[model samples]
Target chain A: MIMTTTAQATKTAPTTTPARSIARLLLHGGTVFALLALIVFFFAMRPDVFLTFVNVKNILFQVSILAIIAGAQTVVMVVGDFDLSVGATSSLAGAVAASLMLTGVPIAIAITVALGVGLLVGLVNGILIAVVNLSAFVATLATMTSVVGLAYLVTAGTTLFDLPDGFNNLGQGRLLNIPLPVYFAIVISFILWGALRFTTIGRRWHAIGGNVEVSRLSGVNVRRARLLAFTIAGLVSAIGGILLAARLGSASAVQGGDNMMFSVAAVFLGMTVIKSGASNLGGTMIGVAIIGVMSNGLNILGVNAYVQQVVTGLIIIAAVTLSSLKTRQR
Target chain B: MRIKFKIAALAAATALSLSGCAASASSSDNGKPLKVIAFTSGNQTPVGAWWVKAVTSKAKDLGWDLTMIQGDFDFQKMNPAVESAIGRGADVILDGYTDIASIGSIVSAAKDANIPIFAMDSSTKETDGFAVNITTNQQQIADATVGALAKTLGDLKGKTVMVIGHDPHPGIRMRADLAKKALIAAGATIAGDDIQKVKSPASGRTEALALVADYLSAHPNGLDGVWVGWDDAALGASKALSEAHSNAKVTGVDATSEAIAQIKAGGNFLATIEQPWPKILDKLVQNVSAYQKDRTLPKTKFEADDTTLVDSSNAANITPSDKLG
Candidate 1:
């Protein structure tokens, strides 16, 4: 009788779940729909310039840095932590990498060192939040301030220049008519998606975030999971810094600071999409694309740049609020 | 037991309160000096350094306490900095205006407070409420740099020259437009066909390096001379070209230390238009001092300095570093 009851419960669960999931889909799916509408509208308005091959390529290239940073931000947020330091870390990594290249260091060695610096910063954040018992918000904010100061100190508050020709190619070169940075983003996103969806470590992260005390009682090694999440975030952010430096062909203290908040906003807005309240890699890609398209579209339409920022902020807030309401109802 | 706990809590609270008060008092009472506020943007740049030096040097001479506020090139921050200076009863305000339109509210507020503001570097035409607008004649500087570049190039009739600068900066844009006009009038063909627009780098150094590399790769033989809208841009371009082993002659406005050094290094930077900031700052201070002594001192717009073309021969004579606000 117990076996029969279990079978019945399983059979009913599938049927009931679809209805609830459909509502969630609408809540999350609306952002993608809106993005598509905006793209079509802009294309129709300025078919000549907006839909050109070069412009499309340019949009992807421009959005690559923002997308990579936003992807890391998603992972940080999934673990119920915020990383305000990602932007500063990116700038530090880029500045250090460019300075190394300017000093005739090999590109590969400079990249490795840059990634190591990012990891060290991440470890500091993880220790502060997990061991010292400080809130991630406050801990990351402190790190952000210090990292910016360190970047400024490293560069002596000046832009590093005269990078080798090879480094400039990273910004200007194209393979099969697609930008190198775009390819980098795609490869990173694939690995991130696999880790988040199929790995045991991913489960642990979700469990710890869902309920920290419960996971600890369950012997889930919550501290390790949290640390790993942050470490991964740091590694990805450093990669973003490297690509940004390559694209700019030089690095300065303020290189990536402007993109930090926007990246976070993109990640938050991503959570409101097809995955509903859940942070998913696919959702992040869509979120990044939406932002990229809108920005490019507005630029093509000749709308004021400042007005575009205002519109983007308002749309992100609205989408997230709607998703939050749906989650509460469920 | 409860009374003992309460006593301990009270003692801790008292200690905290006393420490807080002590910290506040020390910070507030370090000096009761007259406050003079100076506002500019981007602490890392040479311009920021020049402004700080000029303001502090003048303040020292007048025996007034100076507070330097960085606006980060945001006009939004400039308004609040001015308001706060007024709240602090600041004796004088020295500010850089990003745009003439953005300073209307700040100017009106300063007028209401009866505080004299000395506009530096950039200014608005609305001098009715301000003390003085002391600016380097940017149009003249642009024309001089282009003219110098044309002379060096020798028959720029069919040669393509690239003009690089920041278009959002009004002063920079004004100078760039003037230079373009001057170049065209001199029979030089501007490179506006392919990558003709001013390519501003996300960062100055990157822009400079990319520009040099890209320009050289595209034009191997080096067409006409390259004209930069600013000295720093020229310096960056020079660094890139030097690294690439290219001999493209470059010219720019603003005889900054780096630009002069590049010229001295024989990196193909022919000349730069020099603005003597020290002399300009003295004129600014003189105007402000006169206004303070007598409110009726005639409100006047002073063209503080004209641009001079400094090449390798004369670059050595120009002071590489001087305090200018």
Candidate 2:
């Protein structure tokens, strides 16, 4: 809701003009170029450190949770809604799940209950925005505050650690030489990509984003569609929280607390890519990859964290610039 | 803006309280409520919770009225918290902010109102407002911990060490800088201390896991010892070292429970420096109460707390006998 809509994209309308096609290619293609260029730059600077297998794994392992949440953010944005409560929901979910596990609940039950908490938070958000007709921004922002408060209330701001070994393995486990969370991220992104690209529900969501009233007149359940987008956001954030709990081997009031902005940043970067760029899952994945590589590569190069924040601000500007170019092309 | 209203409200209360306070410094203990604003909720961690609990209990024991307001980690929240504190018209205020810079304006306000501020953790050396700053000798603590690292390793000259330190809080930064300096002076080569930067101390485990995973992948076993800024980071690095199949010894400053557990379990952690926060809390409370009666604040600007260096040989002694449960 906070993002300025540059150009209202018409999905499924094939671009016929050559100049338009060229402009679209340049704008969307720049992120791809920036990503590849960053990889090459890091490799050139620190071939032994950056180009190695272990470091590469570390980058992907770092990328997995952000990608998962950003992929969810992509879908939420496509339906003309914003889920600002994503991070808070994830924190609450993680804290509850960890506390439940420590008290001798089965790990599966604990995790399921955590995801269930996410679902309920989503449902409340959906009811407020859809039924009560609250602004998506206000509804989600209100939920964000309450949910964060609930997280601290439940855990009293303590870090819950020493989860059973099975949960640790979920975070650390690898299948077919890839980390477990990486596999989860891949499967989730592709599924979201296919659903957004191929399905009727997905197209209707694009229709809603393009123009909500027109989509409503065309028989789309705009309210229900927006509600579903939020629910998916909740589930995805919960997954992020669960994986983060496993990865860190502990859950705190802030385990996944700083990710909403990262997810939003990724989705906005996603909007600058490809075929009228209606927040595609593919573009969002690319955006997440860019963040992962930049941080890992910079850390490997021993750039100070303060300098790293400056570099990050610069990249966001570059992404915003590309998005403005997309607007100019239209 | 908040300070404006706070001072205005304080003026009203000062009018009301001046008569009571003027009656007698000794008779002022009519159990009139005093206010306490913490950096954040003490319940944020076992140690943090311990601070809150100790203060609350001490207040109850002394028959003093205590109001606890949990501020936040953001430095921006410091002034607003101070304003809220003034609005409450408390006799004395305790400043628990990790950064002393944020408390500067409040200290001025407190001084104008003839209220005393007992700044906790943050060094008040250059600051004039603190009645007494209760803090550790962070540099000396770091030097002792890392100097022991040099002693244990038998020679600092060629041994590789990684200094994992946090950089946000000035007090913590001082300790990290001192640790790094001591390690380098001892002849140890400092490797990558590139753990993720944390806004609050509670998330050290999360950052430590990611940082260690990445760093250990890059430099498998060149490190002979790990010097962390706090015991949380030490505990985290020990876990990471164990995960990566390296047994590099770890030494840190906080005697947090998890770090002690690591030491008792014979993990890579070798030593930690224990800060007696509760004892400091008791002294701060006692002195603040004393000041309230006699209206006499401390002559000393900085009151240094003692820190104990505990290795495996003395890990049990360092264990928190005062359990929260």
Candidate 3:
């Protein structure tokens, strides 16, 4: 119903000049162009460190976890829900996986159980929101608190660093000069992009988010849809947590606590880039790269770490403002 | 129900009277009541666990009445923690956090209340720490490490070095500052413009890894040595140097097991100045006890923890920690 109104509004809207359309396109692709400029500038300044294959690999390796979390966040945001508990969910999963590994659980079984924890948390989040009718924010927040507590409980309030070498290899191993995590991130994003583009469940989420009452009246199975969306978010958060623990060769109660900010920031930034003014897997990945480059590049340039933070905050504000430019007209 | 209620009231009254006697006894006689507000909660279990264990055992050893408050690493939580400690009628307070600037009003308020505050790991103020200030002589550690780096290169006359540290507290900044002075005194050039400060211990490793890589990129083979204030920063710098295959030597403080193991394995990490943190806590407890008996603060405001320089030669005999000790 909301899509129909949007279609009508666009049809009735004033026509734009070819020049104006091209200008809009250029403005929309600013992030892509800005990334290129940053690369060229850094390369000119430091060829050996900035331009090397190893550094490129390092950037990919560092940002790989954030990129995966961002993809998970995009789906939930598209459905007009927030999973604030994802960071804690990741920590809980990591704690469970690492602890299990130490207790002589096979790596394969331990990882599967770790993923199961995420799915289970997602089920709880889904039930609390879709069936029990709690606001997404309040529900996920409750889970986040409890899950963080569970993380500490599982590890007995200490960091677990005594992981088997095989698990460490998962975090550090590279295939064909690329880190294993980078592959996981790329594969997850592509799979999500396909689902969002080609599936009915994915497309209907826009309708549900736009007008939930109308979608329910139109037989949209609103509860089931929301439940599935949350489940997917939880599953993906598990993947991110497991990989992060694997990469660091350590898991602590605080492992995934700060990732919510990164994931949320990346999704919001992606909205401005996609020109759709909504979350998309492709756009989220691009946003992740922009953030990754900014962090890696600023560090490479010998900028004070605090100054890097200021620049990042300004960039986030600019992104939100850019996305709002045309929306203000509506 | 009425009989049970009467019994409960009588029990609470008796308990209150006994508690009153206990509080007055501790206050009037020996200074046995010490309330400790730790920066990290015991639940954090990794970063601030040792401090908790040392202080707890020391409180018992000194026969002090201990009331512990966990700060949970939050600044806002501290004001209440302080107020509660004051409310508990503690004779004195032991603190592990160092954000004196932000927590100044609260600390000053405690001073106004006549409850003296003793700080741990915070810089020594000659008159500030009511009992005695126990702090690590960070400059000496920094200088010692820098001297090691210079010795490794045979001479520091024309070499270049970088000092990497986190500036969450004054001690870390002091260490980095002293390292720079020593490097310059040895006729070495300071790499880049100034010391690279990490934001905190939480992300210290990642930040160090990236910043060191950046520094290495800018200077290439120009850097001769690197000095880090803490083990995490040292680990990060060591990784950057080793991965880059640079010839620069790395030195750091805190003989974290990983750092010792790395040094023993002949990795890029050269040497670390070890300050056994428990020793400082032990001394702080003793000084505070003596102040109660004599009614006088120490003549010297500060007591320093002894430091050991750990390298491949001595790493075999030292214990290593996976996390920063």
Highest TM-score scorer: 2
- lDDT digits (tens) for residues A1-330 of candidate 3: 999999999999979999988768666875666667778877887766786776777788778888878887888888888899888898889899999998999999999999999999998999999999999999999999899879988976666766787987787677997879999999998898988888999887877876789989998999999999889989999999999888767777777566787788888777776655777787788778878788887777778878988888887887778767735633
Q: Which docking class does model 2 fall in?
A: acceptable
DockQ of each: 0.10, 0.38, 0.32
- Candidate 3, DockQ to 2 decimals? 0.32
Best DockQ goes to which candidate? 2
lDDT of 3 by residue, B1-325 (tens): 9999999999999898677645643562643354443333322544466666667776677666677666656658766776766655656667663545556655775665566666666553444634456777776787679879877999999988888877766677778888888888888888766888787665576567677776665556767888888876787788778767897888878776667767877868899977766666667666666656554556676566667889888888775432433
Q: Residue by residue across B48-81, what tens digits does model 2's lDDT show?
A: 6666677777778876667665555554665776
- lDDT (Cα, tens digit) per residue for candidate 1, span A1-330: 999999999988755487777766667577788778888898898776665765677568767888888878878777778799898888998888888887889988988999999988888888888888789999999998899888877776666656776876776567998879998888888888888878988777777766788988999988888888888887888888878877766677777676678777787667777443767677778788888788767644435445676899898887788768757866
Per-model chain A TM: 0.91, 0.91, 0.90
Candidate numbers, best DockQ first, in rank order:
2, 3, 1
Query: How well does candidate 3 score on lDDT at residue B167?
Result: 77
Clashes of each: 1, 2, 2
lDDT of each: 0.71, 0.75, 0.76
Clashes of 3: 2
